[model samples]
Target chain A: DQQVKQNSPSLSVQEGRISILNCDYTNSMFDYFLWYKKYPAEGPTFLISISSIKDKNEDGRFTVFLNKSAKHLSLHIVPSQPGDSAVYFCAADDTANTGNQFYFGTGTSLTVIP
Target chain B: DVKVTQSSRYLVKRTGEKVFLECVQDMDHENMFWYRQDPGLGLRLIYFSYDVKMKEKGDIPEGYSVSREKKERFSLILESASTNQTSMYLCASRRGGSTYGYTFGSGTRLTVV
Candidate 1:
């Protein structure tokens, strides 16, 4: 079973516009959510994260909003740039496990037209 | 910068051949992991080690084994490689406990013919 899902495989946005990527989870035990950005031929880099206690977390141009009631989270990039184009993955931490195993979604590929 | 290094970027092996994928971390992390990334399946953990000489199986550990002889190094072994095993292998390291995220290697693409 897929605990986390990113239904949209790809998304495109115009430069200077907003780019939003959505993710949903079925497991309620997950308390921490993270977004990772991956470039071609490189490993994923951490972008932003939010705890279950917070509804939103922002870092410069990147912001992540979490809704526990919906079991959903989104990553928003304002004034999106060409450099922001890459595969974005949503991951959740399973706190109930001793290893703190992280479950990752299928990932959403984003392309920003500059 | 903290880094996880996988030994090779690409490899080609014949079926039934033994394969070894090596990973090392420079951050002195206490936790290390091995994962396989497929086109549509996302990243699935193969195994992980929280300390030297200790290991645990992840979601898909079949046909795979791991060794962690040193604190900074972890190795994934494929005793008999198969075509279905061809995929991108990633190694990651993180600090022990529940507070940190993982730092990953560039990944090694292995193809079993």
Candidate 2:
């Protein structure tokens, strides 16, 4: 079963436009959420994160919004650039049980067209 | 900076052969994990170690095992390789502090024939 889900397999947006990637989770114990970006050859790199305590966290052009009630979170990038084209993954972790287990989404491939 | 290094970038092996993938991290994090990435199946954890000589099985650990004799080093072993095992393997480390995340290695693409 897919505990965490990213329904959109691919997303396309024009440069200087807004790009949003959405993720949903089934398990409610997850308190920490993270977003990762992956290129073709390299491993996934941490992009941004948000805690369960807050609803939104913004860093420069990247922002993450979390809604605890709906078990959903999203990543938004403003004025998207060509360099931003890559696969994005959403990960959720529950520290209450085994702090090590993290459930990840299938990933959304975002292509920012210039 | 925290850097996680994988021993190989690509590997090809035959079925039933033993395969070893090594990972080393510069950061002295207490937690190291092994995950596999496949098409339509983002990343699935195989195993992890919180301390030296300590190991825990993650979501998918049936065909794999791990060894962590040193703090900075972790190894994933495939006792009998299979074609379905062909996928990208990733290694990551997280500090014990509440930071609660990981620094990842480049990745290893393994193909079993």
Candidate 3:
């Protein structure tokens, strides 16, 4: 069973527009969430994250919103650029567990058209 | 800067052959993990080690095994290569008490013939 899900397989948006990627989790035990961006032929890089205690967190052009009640989170990028085109993965971990095991979503491929 | 290094970028092996994928982290993190990425499966953890000579199986560890003889190195072993095992393997590491997540390696794409 997939604990984390990214329903949208692919997304397309025009340059300088807003790009939003959504993710949902089924397990309520997860307390920390993270977003990772991956380029071709490279490993995923950390993007942004949110704790269950907070509703929103922002870093420059990237923002993450968490809805604990709905078990959902989204990543928003404003004025999207062509360089922002890549696969985004949503991950969650239950810090209460000593193992620190993380679960990952299937991933959403975002293509920013220029 | 934290760096996780995989020994190889690509590899080709025959069925019944033994394969070893190596990873090393420069940050001296206490936790290291191995995961495999398939077409639609994303990334699934195979195994992880929290300390030297300590290993734990993750979600999918049927045909795989792991080794953590030292603090900085972790290895994934395939006892008998199979075609279905042909996929991208990733290694990652994170600090013991750090709030941040893991730092990943570039990944190793292994093909079994």
Q: Which candidate should be chosen as best, given TM-score against the real structure?
A: 3
What are the per-residue Cα lDDT tens digits for candidate 1 across B53-83? 9999999999999999999999999999999
lDDT of 3 by residue, A1-114 (tens): 999999998999999999999999999999999999988768889999999999999999999999999999999999899999999999999888888767999999999999
Query: What would the per-residue lDDT of candidate 2 be over residues A40-108, giving only the tens digit for each residue?
Result: 879999999999999999999999999999999999999899999999999998866655656899999
Flag the better candidate by TM-score, 1 or 3. Answer: 3
lDDT of each: 0.92, 0.93, 0.93
TM-score, candidate 3, is: 0.97
As a whole number from 0 to 100, the lDDT of residue B22 in candidate 3 is: 100
User: Which consecutive 10 residues in model 1 chain A have the weakest lDDT in total?
Assistant: A94-103
Pairs that collide in candidate 2 are none
TM-score of chain A taken by itself, candidate 3: 0.98
Among residues 3 or more apart in sequence or in different chains, the pairs in candidate 3 whose N, CA or C atoms overlap within 3 Å are none
Better of 2 and 3 by TM-score: 3
- Model 3, B18-71: lDDT tens digits are 999999999989999999988678889999999999999999999998999999
Model 3 lDDT on a 0 to 1 scale: 0.93
For candidate 1, list the clashing residue pairs, or say none: none
The lowest-lDDT stretch of 10 consecutive residues in candidate 1 chain B is B93-102
